[model samples]
Target: MPQAQKGICAEPNLHALYLMFNVHEDHDEEVRRILAQILNIFDHYDDEHYEAMVSGVIAIGSNYWMELYPGFLPAELAPFPDMHCEDRHAPVVPCDLFIQMRADRADICHAMGTAVYDALKPHVELVEQIKGFRFLDGRDLTGFVDGTENPKGMHKLDVAIIGDEDPEFAGGSYIHIQRYRHNLSKWNQLDVPHQEEIFGRTKTDDIEFASEMKKPFAHTKRTNLKDANGNSIEILRQSMPYGDMKEQGLFFVSCAKSPQPFTKMLESMIFGDAHGNYDKLMDYTTAETGAAFFAPSVDFLKFQGMS
Candidate 1:
């Protein structure tokens, strides 16, 4: 098996930096050089305390993948599609490249982010950057624990890393990212029971509702998708809460063997079930940015020469 990125299955970090960039129209060659340089730095970084992962967009208009991998691309790779419902919209804003850095300390994450920005200075323009931190016991700003249903142990590897299904891209993972801004004032106005009904779980105890008791439009129910055979589809969530007094919400990060699970979940959230009710969580939060990228194996990056 090819070596996967260290951060995919690593323990959750206390601090993270999410960076997205678009290459200059005529500077594709220069951007490639910068990728190799940044990868070299990641190669020597201490994974015990910090982790870095990189990815490039694979759509037709983006030359990053064509110039590097040529004919090989993740089977499900595509530009993120916009989502709309009766009252809300999730817009698609694709970027050419993405870099994520995580560490236990804020200073370490900052230093790594600065190094990456310096390397790509001349070739790329920043699209979005977010600093995320783990909230109390990994809860979101809404006062409920996040990622309670994520796969654990070896199951995480099974759910996240590409295997025999796509042998050529084995060990790679498809990633989806979005930034959500919360309406804390509106959310805070609701009682605890009302909030729990929206999430389908008890806020204080983190206990999920029984299947029969779950509402059709509850967040947990809407997002939990199953395959045709009735087996549950899973995705590794590395999301974290971000904000200040002015802005606060989640920087959603999801990794999977393929993009199907993430795409399906998003559709369900934005459009709702056959009954036509969407996720109530959206009523309290607004999606500001959405994009998709493919994070390749470490071995692939080391050998694919951009110079």
Candidate 2:
């Protein structure tokens, strides 16, 4: 098995910092070296604070992959699947690099961000940053538990890591992210029962409704898709709710062995089925940005970068 990056399947942390950047022209080699050895930056802090469980991920955006490595591409690598359905939107916001740092301590996550920025200074321009935290007992700001369907234990690796089918990219994972700005004021107007109906789950207990009880447009109904063979298309979800006094929403991130799962899930949510019943939750949240990236295996980053 290839050495997968530690952060890709890392357990949820108390704090996370996501940074997106655009690598400057003529700095490809320098950026490559920095990203290749980024683990050392993470290890430097993790060694002293193992209790913090600090982990990091360095990913190259779909658009920048060819620029960085002109030799070849990950077989399934593709740009963001920007989609629209009536009023629903999944907008594309491409970036050359995406780095995620997570740890139990917000301070450590911040420190990692500082170090990462320092290493890439002048070679990259920071475009966006979203700091996220565990919300109210691992529930979303919407007062519902999140990531309830995440694959557990070794199953996460099975679902999130690429296999021999794409040997060159084995152990790498396809990543898709969207910044959703939720209109909590509007969502809160609904009663618990109404909310539960939209989510297709019991809010307090976080239990999925029976298949027969699930509504066609409920989020779970739309996202819990199946492939042609009647198998569920799964992705390891790494979403968290982020909020400030003025803004609140989800930082939706997911990883899978291939990009198809992410694309298909989004389509199901936006386009719905032949009946045209889309995910009802889209009405309360706006997907502000979307990006696609590939987090290559650790060994690939280490050996391929300087090759």
Candidate 3:
């Protein structure tokens, strides 16, 4: 079958759209019903200060499994057959939203986050309290602009998912969440060049190291996956800066396939493969929470028990 094309709205200004859903045999219909209801709610409540911040939900489940991705993966191992299983049913972890605000507009993000939370409280099985923040400009925990090297346009499709990673769900992928705590004091002490080396890019988003001089085994490069035939995997990243002034950093939401892209990416960061070396950014960022989950295709919900 030829790959189908759908119209995605022009990108919104939202910095992050975090989500997590528990799967079940009966929950398929419930997801559909909930999604429809939420869409209506957003339309009903749409406004300048508060509008539907969703970028559409991709239901990737099939007749056998309601393939919803959690924010993190469990520590216990699963057998190959039970790999995509959804054990917990209720309290479907709530989806989160992060909107952009002016540098000093923490109050606005907070107001919007709270408004969203209140609106969905009654309908959702559970609505996790929303969190929002102002952008820190170009600097990361290490005092440098992060994601300066992010892929854009057609290239993003390749960087996200394009490989043997999962032929069954071509064009579809998984998302992972990791809450990292930064030792800012330590990160602040590093000189500019040292900071740049850790990120494997120039301090500014522009200009990358010549191929030979790049960190061969860097997280920026290794987390990048290609298919069995060497096609790059393409996945969307909607992570955002979330937290208070004293304890702030990324909410780290990465979507990909079977957790391989993310897992392998982290592995490369911790223990670099043959050519590259472990990630230097680790000296500053400390991962505190990790979870993995699947985001099912919209059609999957229709088959499941959705009304």
Candidate 4:
């Protein structure tokens, strides 16, 4: 039997929960209080993490906030999707909150419901009422399966950088989040080979297409970074498969040395360049949300600038 070819890369535990909210400038203090109260409740009741294992940092200068999961959650509360066939596990069965100041109440409700899968856990009962929302599932739009192949072990080191990415950020990395919607009905219509072509790899992430047949024009090819000596630059991809059947998709998050790589990747995705033909997967998905945020090191939270 042929020895199995070693896979080149992997993914780490990637659990994500985000929201954009509305808060008047005058109410910043109150909003911070509400957020802090919620965080406290979760920190106390949440069996998975404590302050040490997790990093709860305030972003947007009390206007925005986020919490990082130090590890995975219990089996009862894990993120699941239909497409994954691997005997796998869930990562960071944690939650987060965001404020939507630009939109009205209805829009905020829809965004949370659609982006966070509130129905699956019943926001009122689990969060507001129970003080926390039990973890649930985040699936991409196509509904076949998602997040089955993630980087683990040294791969985490490869993709998630340390102090090198940002001087002030010694332990943390830059985080980027994008919400994408999938046209599953449309995607389902395409043949499997075509799907594979769009992804630039096998469904299992096991193989790339034959070099000649490979679509050299793709974000994968373009942003597949190389060092000064021409080695692949590594970045951690902790993106989670998110969305429901109707308004579902991915909560794409990546941490890297600099935003340039990701920006260049997106540019290639939007306007196909030489090697990046753009992600053919776009045929079935739409980019609906985009934002860039800095995830500073724990020590750098209080510091401003150069971080």
RMSD of each: 2.9, 0.8, 8.0, 13.4
Each prediction's TM-score versus the true structure:
0.92, 0.98, 0.63, 0.57
> Relative to the unseen true structure, what is the C-alpha lDDT of residue 216 in candidate 3, on a scale of 0 to 100?
61
TM-score of candidate 4 versus the correct structure, residues matched by position: 0.57
lDDT of 4 by residue, 1-307 (tens): 1111011122222232344333333443344334434333323422343222222322231113322222311111112111111221112222233321111122332333343333222322222111111123323444333433334676664454444433434454445555666677788898877776676556544365555666765334544645579766555554545554356566665555455556555555555655435556665676555555444343342222222
Off by over 4 Å in 2: none
Of 1 and 3, the candidate ahead on lDDT is 1
Indicate the worst ten consecutive residues by lDDT in candidate 2. Answer: 298-307
Residue 216, candidate 2: Cα error in Å is: 0.6
Predictions ranked by lDDT, top down?
2, 1, 3, 4
lDDT of 1: 0.80
Instruction: Give the whole-model CA lDDT for all candidates, comma-separated.
Output: 0.80, 0.92, 0.44, 0.40
lDDT of each residue in 24-139, candidate 2, tens digit only: 99999888888877778898889989999999888899999998877869999999998988999999999999999999999999999999999998799999999999997799
Among all windows of 10 consecutive residues in model 1, the one with the lowest summed lDDT is 54-63
| lDDT of candidate model 3 versus the reference | 0.44
RMSD of 1: 2.9
Give the lowest summed-lDDT range of ten residues in model 4.
1-10
**In candidate 1, how many Å is residue 210 off?**
0.5
Steric clash count of candidate 3: 33
- Which regions in candidate 4 have their CA more than 4 angstroms from the true location? 1-16, 26-42, 45-151, 154-167, 210-212, 302-307
